[model samples]
Target: MSEFFQQPPRAGNRFHTDPSLRLLTQWHLPDAIYEQAEPQLERMGALADEVMGALAEQAETNEPEHTPYDAWGRRIDRVRIDDSWRELMRIGQREGLVAIPHERAYGAHSRVVQAGLVHLYDPASAVADCPLVMTDGAVTLLQEHDPGLAEHYNPRLTAREGAWTAGQWMTEKEGGSDVSGTSTVASQDADGRWRLYGTKWFTSAVTADMALALARAETSAGEDQGLSLFLLELRNADDTWNGLEIRRLKDKLGTRALPTAEIDLVGAAAVPVGSLGGGVRKLAGLLNVARFWAAIGGPAGVGQLLALARDYAGKREAFGSLLRDNPIHRRWLARISADYEAMLALNFETAAQLGQSENGGPKELARLLAPLNKLACARQAAQTGSELLESFGGAGYVEDTGIPRLFRNLHVHCIWEGTTSVLAHDVVRALGAPENAEAFADDICRRLKNLTTAGTARVKQKIESELDVLMPLVNDPREEEARRIGWGMARIYQGVLLAEFAEWKKSAFDDDAGFATAELFCRRGLVDEPFPETDADTAGRMAFGS
Candidate 1:
């Protein structure tokens, strides 16, 4: 009986196996840009199967440790991470994970290519992408504000060699998403150096060499306008502590392999990135970039979860039959797959727009879509992860199976960068811009114009109606109204993207998977239909129809 045990599930190169990802990228990028990125994508595909697959398991099991002092009681404040974690970082740097878009080697399509690579790498990298997000944002922020800072740090941040990552330290005890409540005070010293003097409550990736932080500068001004953005170097030129004290490392729910800590700044030497009064405005760039990365992480995680669950279903047997043969299980898997496919379309579409915006195209719609994408994808990833875990039955509950980690890692996506409630409010605020609202509505209309299917037309009408109901309330929305309207808007937008992409899939590849996914998304996600149980044949067709 023991010898007859089922063989462990094996995953091939994630990039090569994911047809949806390939098709989406092909549809999104220009031929010239795709040609430039093809080699890198192929390399990443192979690495994802070999290096990342093993490292992910090692990273979760080993986790990270915070050693505040050495054996002699010196204030070392060293974070001891698994060797696998370090190797992952090295791989990220070597692969130009952070450099590609910034380098712009592929012209206007750089961000599109970079986003595609991130979608492939993030899930297998064991959340190492968290710090990469900050690093990339910091590089962009510095480039826009202080060229000298960019010249000094951008090379190292994006280095494929001796790269050093950056962190974003905005959360304090008084404020999570509300940067206006930040109390960390920045004071100019006799040498004209700005020094931060307060505690940062939640600083992830404490191992970073430098961080972009928000601090209120001392001034006669009575308002939060005194808040400023500062660049704090964690270590000095002599490689010594720079008046930063690590209070303790956080015991987090997930991403445990990435060190997160609370720290007190006592005269921590810093440099101002932008004008003191423009901190919030300047930090917007970083927030947008971070939110975009957070958005991509959702579908990437969902892809991994679905792959694991589907593979497990094929192998695991119950009552003289494989789990994949169970009709009810297939239905559940199909629904999750449909949601995943819709999210991929929505995410990559946003990615394409972001690339265009960077290359001097329109920015208004991307601004509105970033937060919406983040909120929708994060929530869906968490829900799908939970469902995938359940499909594995008792084995999923055990740590050894690695399925539990998917759920644990996904939960953080909802809370990190910004909570769901915070993001919903952000969507309302973005909609307050009349031009942004107009652009969002116009884009949806344009995409829907190409889809002639009756079901799709109905989805489009429903979305427009929902937007009609929500648009008027954007100016002065109550919290409950904002949440309701924001979620509705996100669903409608996702449905539109799916419907458009499904049409493309049918026309270009003669694939019905996209249509099936779009149908499932609209019926269940937009119209609130109950889950349906299907026979094995119907279940297989619906779930894996693509």
Candidate 2:
């Protein structure tokens, strides 16, 4: 057999060959998955590399005021946010602005997309622009803030062509993540304007051009319903700031480049997204895509973190030996590498699954996996960042190394979207459906049976044990303990997936081994875990606050 055809297959590995860093070199996506997505990813790589390079340069300078900008001549341009905020807002109306420090939206989009991808289905109306809009939200915001740009509001272009930036209207003075407790009153004006009359705590208060605002609508019964979605455009008659006011910009520990603002709406001009009471549901469509983006971005950040660390280890000598030559450093690098691979495979699988989502309705499994991926990717990124940063000693603590910024940027992943606790609750919900969980688990079991690695077998046993604790709870419909038990079950599921992916990394070249490991992971994580709560009620509360 020829060299290419004779490639060996293992149980837990997912690659046609040993999955390596080079896997990204070729965007090998099935036509059904992303006919254009692979190309898009390729385009994004250049952008990512440029962004990383700019960050590296800025880090070397160690100047806080100097913003990171891609030195890449043209493809990736640099735009100053604070310097040119006025002009960029104008251009954003028509072309749409890209908003980075895209912490919340990124997490939301990534989680949703991850869920859809695992089921090989689409969660929204299968809208093509949804993904593009979510991905470009941060980028567009940067463009708008830069002085070189001009702002013009174009309703027609926005509705059709789609842009990368998005506005988040999630926080209320009463509660940030808890929408059920929201009291934002929405009344229809004589002129048919849906007026929102309430204070928003974190409205992207200043910079956001487009928003998915949540407010209560009056029903025929003279009572208010849960919430509704309003798409608000914040531009004016002479091309100036409309009614949306930026109360203040928050000074935060990380993502300093991305500004956070508290906003208030004084009879702000707005448009409805879908239906009045459908704000939660309508926003779900956008949020899903946002969550998926967040999940994937975490891994991307982790990759950048590891790359910088690896370079440092190879060159930095300590205690009369190269860092790589040191046993402790080697062990640390190995652990980080392994976690990184597990994260990548998990993120990629969900991405591939999302690319395959169609009209029939996304697989139910996707719903369950969204939280799992979000939890896994975010936690992994945070863990990897801390571990990798520690390996650098004092250099990791400073900005010049290019590792500290990554560490800072990744810290917020767990805070936004659906927090870790929220995700744990979701896993419990998935366990509620034993048949569904079992089917998901069974599929993984079938995959596990075909593996060759001892790691695969070990991981498989671990997953089975988790399912044993989870299955009964999932089957129970008891109301009082449902929420708590479900949360625990999700945690178990996540552990299984982590273990399974560990096996996949060890045997990426062996199809049988990889497949089995993937199965074991899915059975434990995706099939068994319940969906998490994304509503404001869960998000606004601190676990120990009460």
Candidate 3:
């Protein structure tokens, strides 16, 4: 026989295979909502598997190209992407990945269903979700600030055929996260039209048809009355470039498939979207939506890693036995699996709260949970991806193995929308509101009320005790202290969420994995029973000398 190596088979239909995700949707969503979303979920699941399995190799190899000018030196600033990328976008729009929530076709359950679909679709889309995040944010902002703009742009943004995406341009060279330092100036033209003249330091999806930006309106006030939000169309009605010049595409550590650029705006015609001085207030809607999207990406990436690692375990063998049969290997796999489950529980619960807020439920809890969930899930994804790579041995580190991308893609979630420190401060600010803090505490208690097992109850008590200590510090927490508290709060929240799901699964699906997962997560994450450190020789032999 010829010498050969065995490899794991490609993933099958993701929706059908993932029992936890299916149970999560059933447990969190209302019956009517689940029924309405079922068909769409199935379609997205199949598409996701196809994208990650058959088309993933080519898609990963394809990097977006920036064409700055036409052959005749006309300023085009075109970005060329692969056909596979375009097809993925078309599939996403046709599935109403971004539109369903905005349109509210399913009433109060729209956001929940939309979030679930995005969770399934994000991992295989090769960062196409980046533009979708901004597009969804723009839709939400426009719908509230200027209904006229929403009416004109919503169709284009949501359409599967002839779709047009939107971008967000906010960061300037001087102001990385501080919009108060915005120096972009807007002035009135001879025709009494608003025009923007400034440079945007970091603009993602630069080839987008339009962008929502922040520029200070030139006023005589001395107090620097905050930046105003404006909508700038990238092209004129005649298909010519507007008064915008793309400086160059950004060289990023990851997300290379998505084109990001720096651009200078000169006489670029714009229209004010919201109140002149209420720019920060108006941006709340976009920030909320984008943060939720950011939170979901982590779980989705971890799901991909778990799938790859699990498949490889059953196929690869050593010492005349399969890796899946080894207790040590199984322990590592179990830890990652439990972590992923706990993260999904937290993320979906937050999604449920967000959906409920749209129907007159408490909005404050959603506010607090969005940043917390994003920060925690992003951290989990990075750590889990690293371990999963190690679990696959040396093959995981290779590009062709398709494992490295998960790790690279996951790191972006830590920095995108907001960093851990930025979000930690936001959490502190949210908790400052008395009503918000009360609502959060009430929700956590409600989830824990049904814990029947003594072990689960003990875990719940520990989490509550931690919350008691953390809530008092919210009012006067220093930056570093606030970050530390934020991490603790996230662990408590995830533990509580996992316990709730465990109880539900025990009753409904007769599944014990959920309970086991919850127990493991609480013991490790909340109780702080971290794995012990080993000697250098042992670590070296395990990590490399094998």
Candidate 4:
């Protein structure tokens, strides 16, 4: 008898392996634009397999180390990460992951190309994508609000040779999401320079070159009108700490490779990005982009695991046949894949809308889609990630197989820019505004106006029904029903987007399962098929403390 040894799952180049991403890119980009972008996309895809996969494996074995002192025990406050992390950062810079959209050589399709790059990078960058996300947001905010700072910083932010990673410093000990209650204050020094004087409770990009922070700056009108956004350089020209002291690194649940720190900002030099008392309003630009990252992250992470599962199914034999040949396993994978397909479609739609806004297109539609895309996509990714990971059976739970990392890394997206509940409220508020509500209605009509496929008609009908259910909550804009409203809106849009993809697949590629997949996704995903009344009642009675 021959000894049995399991064959490890293999993943090839991301751009070539992912037909869904390829098709979407082809659909969004013209032939001329695609010709320009395809080589870069393919290069990043190869990096995903050759470089990032190894880095991810290395990070699992070795975490970032914080040494508060040198050998002589002086306060150096040094955080040392593996060389692999640095390599990942270089790839992000070299490949123009953050710079592509900002560069805009491809016109409106630039963001679509950038999104593909980001989705490919996120799964294996060992959470290096965290700093890049903040960097992109900082670049966007600085370019829009502060010209001098933008001129000084953006060149570094977008540079390929010496790119800068910017930390987002918003959460403090006093408040997590509610920045209005912030205690950190920014005051002018004797030199007429603004300085931040407070402790940041949590800062994820502790190893960043610079940081974007929110600081309390009061005016005579009210003593505390609101917060203002500030940009902080972590180091001086001599490379010493510039009025900043790292207290300690966070002992976190996951993302061990990403250095998160608690630090004291005592007289840290800062410059306001906008008006002194306008950060609460001005912060929308940064938050909007960050939420888009969170939304993309959900699907990107799931796609990573799904890619592995795709390989494993063809090789792993069970009940005298490969798992791919087994009806039950194959059907289960198809369902999870369908949901992943739905999320990619929706997030890419968000990307396209954001691109339009960037290139002097409709601003209101982008604003409305921001919160809706983040909440809905994050929630769906969480569910789909769990299901896909479980498809590997025992190997899914094994850390050595690199499968369990999906869940550990996935929880952050659900809470990163905003928690699920927080984003739901944002969606409701966006809809509450009259102009935003009007733009949203027009967006729905615009997205669904051209339907060429029969499946799209069914998808359209299903979406109309969901709109009937969810549109009322948006019109009334209640807090309690915000979750349903936000999620329902996302589901409807995803259904329509997937239907459109199905039509393209059939007409362009002569595929039939594309239609079935979209139909099944809508049927299963659009509404919460209510559980049995007795089962729910009993479950509720026995739940938790009860």
lDDT scores of the candidates, listed in order: 0.81, 0.50, 0.80, 0.83
- 102, model 2: CA deviation in Å? 20
Q: lDDT tens digits, residues 145-182, model 4? A: 88899999999998887898898898988888877667
Candidate 3 residues 209-240, lDDT tens each?
Answer: 89998888864333344578999889899977
Q: List, residue by residue over 340-458, the lDDT tens digit for candidate 1.
A: 87778778877777777878899997898788888889898888878877877887798887777767888888888898889988887887778887897677778767778754666
Task: Give the distance in Å from residue 144's predicted Cα in candidate 3 to where it truly belongs.
Answer: 1.8
RMSD of each: 7.4, 11.8, 5.6, 3.0
User: Which candidate number has the best lDDT?
Assistant: 4
Task: Output the worst ten-in-a-row residue range by lDDT, candidate 4.
Answer: 217-226
Error of 2 at 114 (Å): 11
TM value for model 1:
0.92
Candidate 2's error at 353, in angstroms? Answer: 3.3
- For model 4, the stretches where C-alpha displacement exceeds 4 angstroms are 71-73, 218-225, 525-546
Give candidate 3's total backbone clashes. Answer: 0
For residue 59, model 2's alpha carbon misses the true position, in angstroms, by 12
lDDT minimum window of 10 residues, candidate 3: 523-532
